[model samples]
Target: MFTGIVEELGEIVSVEPHGEAARLAVRGKVVTSDAKHGDSIAVNGVCLTVVDVEDEVFTVDVMRETLNRSSLKSAQAGARVNLERAVRADQRLGGHIVQGHVDGTAALLSREPGELWDDVRFSLPRELNRYVAEKGSIAVDGISLTVTSVDEDSFGVSLIPTTLELTTLGARRQGDLVNLEVDVIAKYVEKLVVTK
Candidate 1:
């Protein structure tokens, strides 16, 4: 339910552990400006519901499943995370549809920099190789990007200056872990074809 366009780079305020969950507080200006209890927000590619709201800060309860599937487990105070609110009906679809449901995490294999751009290669789960395609859409850390190329074991995406400055990807280095969500449409198509 998000466009994958980052609204703001929010910082983690705190991470507190509960029985089988963790409570995360984030400080964001744009996303929290109109956020209320029960609103959905994407933090580092994971969609979480708002349980509490204060000025420039909102709290969300991260269940065990979310922690296991996404990058939130390693999240700490002051960590810069990409934030995006649910897409509105009248707004333009600037980025592809991102459900905030991360399929798995990928490791940054390498980064090649250019004068004003960069290409980052990532090693994804081998099982997901079937879903990724060249020129297809992929969501990394809640930012929508196109697959510049795909190989048997990995993929690469070119990041422009705007993407570098607006999201957490700018801070990533080799061996860094990032949450990834593949195109939902591709998954559905594959499912139908397999059932035939």
Candidate 2:
């Protein structure tokens, strides 16, 4: 598990095909500082195990199912990704419970900039619409953000200057796709209600 708090903005060093899967090497100094083989790290909201660790780079394999369900399918050598280590039991839950399991991808609809913040809109997937709500928490590209508003087909989040400068969402443009993970608590509640 993770807290959806980005520890560093890592760059994809390379991605190579390995039969039906792809091996990805990411360059991140902070996240790889103490990383070891078999350690789990959240990359753009997807939990990936560390297959190898060398210096400031760590490698993980992306299977076909993961590639098809997240934005990683189009990942290139120069793409920037949000990186976070798995949360420790002793650490405080600063953001929220994030399983690093992406529900789906959302397209960047638009960005309305302000002097100190920006309201970014994204096209919410129809199947996941009911799981989102105004003022609820949503993980976008692994960064935890609060929903400023929600409509039938889209949702908006306010990003402060810190977020714009520290994470991948800052550079996202119109029509770009991003990985999204809805609040797991909401899904559990729904399941319990239906079963009851």
Candidate 3:
């Protein structure tokens, strides 16, 4: 599990394609500080296992299912990815609970810069709309952000300067694809209500 707090902005060093799967070598220093083989790393909201680690670079296999579910299908060597290590048992929860399981992908619709922040809008998948609410937390490209507003088809998030300079959201352009993981608690509540 993760807290949806991005630790470092990493770069995809290389991508080697195999049949129905691909191997990605990502370069991240901070997240790899104590990482070893089989450790989990959240890359753009997708939980990937470390297959090999060498010199601040780690390799993970991206399966066909992962590629199909998230924005990783378009990931290439030069892509910038938000990276976060798994949350420890005794650590504080700086962000909401995130399973690194992306519910779906969203497209950047527009961005409006404010005096102290930027209000960015993204298209919301219809199936995921019920889980998103105004003032609710959502993980966008692995960075936890609060929803400023939400419509039937889209939602907006206020990005502070720190977020603008730290994560992939800072460099995201209009129409770019981003991985989205909604709050896990909301989903669980919905499931329990249905079963009750």
Candidate 2's error at 68, in angstroms? 1.1
Among residues 3 or more apart in sequence or in different chains, the pairs in candidate 1 whose N, CA or C atoms overlap within 3 Å are: none
lDDT of 3 by residue, 1-196 (tens): 9998899999999999898999999999998999999999999999999999999999999999899989999889988899999999999999889999988999999999999899999999999999999999999988889999999999999999999999988889999999999999999999999999
- Write one digit per residue (lDDT tens) for candidate 2, span 18-137: 877899999999999899999999999999999999989999999998998899998899899999999989999989899989999999999999989999999999999999999999
Error of 2 at 143 (Å): 0.5
The lDDT of each candidate is 0.94, 0.95, 0.94
Alpha-carbon TM-score of each model against the true structure: 0.98, 0.98, 0.98
10 residues in a row with least lDDT, candidate 3: 71-80
- Model 3 scores a TM of 0.98
> lDDT score, residue 38, model 3?
94
Q: State in Å the error of residue 21, model 1.
A: 1.3
Error of 3 at 81 (Å): 0.8
Candidate 1: global Cα-lDDT? 0.94
Q: What is the lDDT of candidate 2?
A: 0.95
- Tens-place lDDT per residue, model 1, 101-192, is 99999999999999999999999788899889999999999999999999988999999999999899998999999999999999999999
